[model samples]
Target chain A: MNMEVAHTREEDKDLLKVAGEIDAYTAPELREALVPLTEKEGNLVVVDLENVDYIDSTGLGIFIGALKSAHNYNGDLKIIGLNERVHRLFSITGLDEVIDIGEEREEAK
Target chain B: MGDAYLRLQEQYRKILNQYLENKNEQGLYHAQQFSKKVLENQISPEEVVSLHLSTLEESFPDIPKGAQDSFEFLLEVMIGYGLAYQEHQSLKDRQRELESEIDVAANMQQTFLPSGIPEPEDLDVGVLSVPASKMSGDYYHFVHDENDCLGVAIADIIGKGVPAALCMSMIKYAMDSLPEQRLQPADLLANLNRVVEQNVASNMFITMMYGSYDVRAHTFQYAGAGHEPGFYYSAEADEFEELSAKGIVLGIKRHAEFREYQRVVAPGDFIVLLSDGVTECRTEQGFIEREEITRLIRNHMHLSAQEMVNHVFHELEKLQGFQLRDDFTLMILRREV
Candidate 1:
């Protein structure tokens, strides 16, 4: 998957927009982008998965990794802009409860 | 010429006899060296024929003409050695192609697993999902939210190989699109059931379990959809009880309502979630039962989470006499205050 990060000077929030299929092959690309932001600024990191066309367990693992990394830093990561496809994945896995996810990126935070 | 040819013929006979004695081992080493040095140079094809004919005539002068055709027959036999080398190369090429295909499939399967367990609060969650084939029929996912609520699932799609994996991706998509339902496990599954039934093939169905755990409430609400009844081990009660909520498998029918089961996970209480791969895990001996599983868990209850899981897998291996016939997926959730 392709990833692009947009961080504002608001001092607490980092927005990341990901594109492509976030299955086992492209998950690490997302993980590498998210894990560092968790350490540097700590968890107002909002991941936009709306542009993500496809995802599998590997992508789910990257979300888990980022969530853990943010928690370890005493902050939290939230997911936003999940299309119907991405949203269903979180729901079926019941991940919606584990990581804060929403239809909008702002609401996820 | 006469004396030299006699000496060469005698040398060839001695080497051939030696080669026969060793059957191409120690004697062939000497025979090949002698032939390369002396036989190829001093012995022409016609001269060697004459030498062999003279030797045979001396030994069997009264033999019939049919017996005297042995020299021509030996030349034909020598050409087959080159053909055998070419046949060996053909077999090697086929073997290499098979190995390459297996490598590609294995790499694809590896992409399906979580790199590691996610970090969450007051809970120890560990999962083990392995396939016995290049592609597995098993899959799992875990999600933890800021409110300390966690969602966990383990699924085994029916069938094996690429078809099962393709169905698994569809199942995952359905699960991902599920919306928040105000802590209703049953509704969560019912929604998933509708999504799966729409997308999957007629022959495919998935047995799965989905759970939502609230850390503050310390309660676990979960629903099962045609999966085996896994256990919720109560350290406080000192016993294990089945956590069963059976319904029709997703993708089998639309409007299937999966029942939900709930329990307050006290500090020291946890649940075990599994796919049928664990229960129906077959061996040459027979199928493993819940009693045997409980005994093994009790034996290794004190081990670390991952170690405990490994011990259970080892038991499964023993049952199969050290060969797994199916994918095995297990999830252990332990709550801690």
Candidate 2:
């Protein structure tokens, strides 16, 4: 399925709320939207994957690259609102250990 | 008349031999230089053709009556040979240029790697890296923070050669620019993902493992971006386990997330990180299992970290007949109580 990203700014962080399936074909669009946000020095970024139905390896890669970019500027990127399946995917791949995933939906913000 | 014809034939034979053997511009130029001699000797193309026909007739006395046709064919063959020789020379020159370009790129890639492994207090670290070809798609790095926190990263680009090298450099620069506050493994990878997504081509991706070990806390915090799972050796249990973290590869999506995992390392506990080149080592029976790597590490566990890595590499190399099919990187982080 096609992916959609909704962007907003909250406090000092760039909030990107993404919905839809993220796979090989649609991951680039998400990358295009998120790359510029990480470029600014010390820009706090938050990604809400609550509505994301599926995430493949490609989609995961984009998030990792974005996190690196933010860190380069001394900024931070946090992921919040991962659904059960998505969280399980992270556990399976062992990415749960590498990124900041907010367990409670309220804590994500 | 006979003497002059013999002299012409001998000269033509000598020129043909020179051109065929050297197959260079100089040889062709010599032939051009001798063209004037042919004119001065009043020898026509027909005379040359006749000389060739006579030589053929000597070998086949009962030859067919198509002497003139045979001469024409021979002339065409010579012209074709000359053209092929020039094409071959140009191709060789182009190949040489390409080889040199790859050499330069390979050298540049090397500079991006850490010149020497850092030896932090109370920690033993070792690394071994080998490219499958002149260039590698794998990269490993180490950064020490002011608080004595050591950050280790091992990454693999999706492809090899110049593009992969360029991607690796971007990773290095991004890591270097990371702010102190963002030194956490998860934060570091998140920042790096943005850099990679923006700079790296859409067709390419990267897998990485970034970990930070706090000397005082004795905790190892790490994150993985679709990279291969490393191995963890727990001295208390005297067993080996997989250091598996979940994250996707870099450059695939704009807003993705990676989960971080942490473990408290005790004395005699160590972590081993490696690229797929190590786990995917090919055998006649297919890929070597992940357990093989753990076994190798276990067998050499008594040695120092560096020597252990060396021994594992040597043994794997022996298994593969000393030929690596992919970029190989192995790293070890051990704590001494």
Candidate 3:
């Protein structure tokens, strides 16, 4: 299915909530939205993939690219609300070790 | 009047013959030089059409009254053809430039592959790699260290062509610069991840399986960074087990960690590693089952390691109608009793 991305600003952090599949075709949209945010200095970019049903290698690549962009600007990028399958995918690829993954906001507090 | 018509027809035929016969650059140069003179003389398109139409009128005084409109329509068509020809020529030139660029990128990508597979004592190794296009996103390297350990790594970039080739090159140099981390699979991948995250573009990442097999210890230690899971075949028990590990792909995070998995190689046991091109092989009915690959490996287990790899490749290629849609890389390591 096509992906839907919603952007919102909470205090100093930028949140991008992504829904639907993030594959070769739809990942570009997410990249376009997140890359600029990552480039901003000291910006905290959190991508919510809670509703994202599937993510392929291409999608993973986009996230990596955004992460690098954030790091370059001394900013930070985090991912939150991954489903079991998506979490397994992140773990399998060992991305769980690198990216900041947060629990649901309420659970964390 | 008839004489005048015949002479005009003769002149037109002569010009056409001249162009067709002298199709070389010299002929074209002369034509271009003549056209420059014509332009200097200020010959308008309407005047040119009128000049031909006047000849037709002179040749046949009794010509149909509607012929002027026909000639004007013909002039418009000719103008359209000229514009189309110019467009086509520019497109051909652009295509040539693109072809040469792809050729250069393909050559550079070739250097990233292992020059030769190292033959470690007590182990047989085989490798088959092919790219679906001019540039491949797949990469494999074998590093044999002084400690009787062989490091095997297979990686696939997310995209293809020059970008992917560049990523593979970065991975190669990164691995080379980290000589101390080669023995430990998890450490090697973690280090490689940092290199990739720091260097590669945000839109690119690599999935890789890195392993080191110590011949004296008979142990294979491995780690995966979102790479395809390989299979371990036990000839003694006649079972195929997967070499699965947890990790995210490289370049995704600065501090990505990969867990290392280890297996003690028993005699008659073989490890098979492959890119997604193998497991994602498409058939008329869609992707073939991963079990089919395991079955192919089991069927060829009796042969030498190289032959076994070849057999599976041959069968898979046949299934794909000899046309692969992605980069394919398969490597096999076997312990001979």
DockQ each: 0.01, 0.12, 0.49
Query: Chain B alone, TM-score of each model?
Result: 0.74, 0.80, 0.81
Q: Mind giving the per-residue lDDT tens digits that candidate 3 earns over B1-337?
A: 4554455445544454566677777666655664554344444444456556765676567778788779978787667655665677679889999999899878877877888888888899999888878888899999898899999999999876667787788888888889664459998999888888888766778999999999899899999988888999887898998887767788766787778899999998989999988887888876688899999988888888888888998899999999987788999999998
Name model 2 segments beyond 4 Å from true.
Answer: A1-109, B1-69, B180-182
* Residue B333, candidate 1: C-alpha displacement in angstroms: 0.1
TM-score of 1: 0.58
Q: lDDT (CA) for every model shown?
A: 0.71, 0.81, 0.82
Best by lDDT: 3
Q: Which lDDT tens digits does candidate 1 get at residues A1-109?
A: 3544444435568888776677545666677777888886445788877667656544665676677677778888888888766675566544565588965533444
Model 2 has fnat of: 0.21
Decide which is better by TM-score, 1 or 3: 3
Instruction: Tell me, per candidate, how large a share of the native contacts it keeps.
Output: 0.00, 0.21, 0.86
Candidate 2 per-residue lDDT, tens place, B108-195, comes to 8899999988888899999999997899889999888778788899998865567677878888888888875646787778888888
Model 3 chain A: weakest 10-residue lDDT segment is: A100-109
For residue B92, what is the lDDT in candidate 1?
Answer: 80
Candidate 3 positional error at B16, Å: 12
| TM-score for the A-chain in each candidate structure | 0.82, 0.90, 0.93
Give per-residue CA lDDT, model 2, range A1-109, as digits (tens): 6888999988878999999988657888998999899888888888999888667555766777777777778887788888866776566544565578877555443
